[model samples]
Target: MGSIDKYIFKTTLASFALVLVSLTGVIWITQALRGIDLMTSQGQTILTFLGITGLVIPALVLIIAPIALMIAISHTLNKLATDSEIIVMNAAGFSPIRLFRPFFLATCVVAALVAFIGAYLAPDGMRRIKQWDAEITADVLTNILQPGRFAQLDQNLTIRIRERLPGGVLGGVFVDDRRDPQERVTIIADHGTVQKTDRGSYLVLYDGNLQRFEVGKRDPALVAFARYAFDMSKFSQGRDVTLGIRERYLWELMWPDEEDKTYQQLSGQFFAELHDRFMAPIYPFAFAALTFAFLGAPRTTRQSRNFSIGGSVFAVFGLRMVGFACSVMAVKTPLAALVQYLMLFGGIGVGVWMIVGGVVVEPPPRLMEAINRNNERIARLFRRPATA
Candidate 1:
């Protein structure tokens, strides 16, 4: 690569890295705040939280990579124009296509990185996050109860304990269980402890009072008991992970079931997601080109800098939103998919047109005359004194 190309490449890459990190940090912070309470309630260790956070990196990359690339290219080119480097290059007989090569190369490298993360790393990370979340939920469900507190296990079960014993035992226990809709039962025990048997896990009570109230009957029956047991195993089932098109791999989406109607719908969604993942990386380059086509100009005047940079950034954002809307609509209308592809091709066409269309305008005659006059005055000011 020539000196100018190398210079532009380095500048663009530096900008891209800065933007990518800033954007990813913002996203990570948001996710961390939202999940911190759930993690603490589940008694998850720091390492577990970090691991899950790490697993989210690819997902963040999927959103950050394209925007970073677009911003980087726009900023770098704008800087070059503002500094008159582009003017010098043009003066040296370089065309817009020649100047664009470095930026395009950088875009290609970023696109490759995005593709790798989207196609492989993202799916694997999502799976790990799901698995860890499920394990944490199970732990919380089984171990959240504490002594001397009113613990509500679910909608139908509540238990209060006065104290915890050495083992998994409780003293002065009160239990209200309403699993049966026809009858409601309340039990009070002077002492109780959890027990695991061949049948299931249960809480065995001693010296307790039992009250049974039938739903329809007005009469409530009370019975005093020396021993009583209530089953606790029924509440131990872990939470199920939600599997969506984003969570499944390509093959799972394609062949969810041979004979299920839901599978066919899922298969369609998966196909759309797969195509989107593959297409996401290219968006960076396409957006970069589109921005450049609209913004690349020789900054011969102050107005040119403001016009090109502001207009380019606004146009880039607008195009991105349009593309996202089209992708969403594509889920229901196949024609929207064509629109997405057209956006990409349209970006390329714009770039090619910019390269082939020649510079937007010749340097203003008045500005050129003023610049020449300034040079002449400077030369005269620096001249040797006339010979004596």
Candidate 2:
């Protein structure tokens, strides 16, 4: 790249980085505040919360990068115009289209990064977050079974533990299992322990008393047991993690059978997403051209630089909102397919018109000089008014 190209690229990138960081900070703060109660209630550690929050950054960048690029490009160009650098380039016969090339390249690089995250990395991260949450929940529930207390796992099962051993063994254990409607089983064990094996988990009791009550029976049978086992496999299955929409890759969404509604949405979303991924890279170029159209007029001492820059920035934001709204609506309707093209080619057309069609009329530098000279003369006349 040439010196001018390098300068423009660096300035635009620095501005884009600042905007991205500011926006991400705001988003993170909002999310953390909203989930603080849930996090505290679940005893989630700070490291786990941070891990989940970190995974969310890529998704935020995918949404925020385009708008950031647009603002950054516009601001960078406006600064150049204010500093008279744009005037020098104009004098050197470098057209606005040529000046926009560097910004366009930068946007392409950012777009590629966004695509990498949106397509693969973000989904994988989301899956990991879900899995981590499920494991934490399982651990919390299992730890709730305390010694010397009547611990109720559910309405159907109640357990009382006299003592707990260092190896997760319980002595003087009593369990009332009411899962079967036809019969209720009561078990008292001198010793028992929670064991996980290939077949699944079990609570094995040694030197236990087993009492079975059968419906319509004359007498309840009580049997003394040397060893008995109660299956605890259900708890593990209850916490089994299932993948959702954010967990699946783009291709998986594209070929959904009948099993996943998330996949169906993914299929629809992918079309719009793909269009956006490619279209977003060119926004910096469009923004650069728009800035040139709005602010590349001859330098005027009378014009307030801040007002001009603010107006250009406002226009950039408005255009971006329109594009985002249109893209969202199009994703669900047939209109999205065409809207992608409209936003892309329409932006390009505007840029081309501003650069090549001579529609953006630069103010005559001589006119500005004349205005300044006339203002000075008017001031001089006012100062001499006492002679009248």
Please report the candidate that would top TM-score against the real structure. 1
Instruction: List TM-scores for all candidates, in order.
Output: 0.69, 0.65
lDDT of 1 at 286: 80
Give model 2's clash tally.
1
Tell me the TM-score of model 1.
Answer: 0.69
58-109: candidate 1 lDDT, tens digit per residue: 8888878988888888788778877888888888888887788898889888
Residue range 126-162, candidate 2, lDDT tens digits? 7887887676556422456566788777688888877
For candidate 2, what is the lDDT?
Answer: 0.70
As a whole number from 0 to 100, the lDDT of residue 63 in candidate 2 is 71
Model 2, stretches more than 4 Å misplaced? 138-151, 155-234, 239-246, 254-292, 296-301, 305-311, 357-388
Model 1 ranges off by over 4 Å? 140-148, 152-242, 250-262, 359-388
Candidate 2 backbone collisions, by pair: 330-336
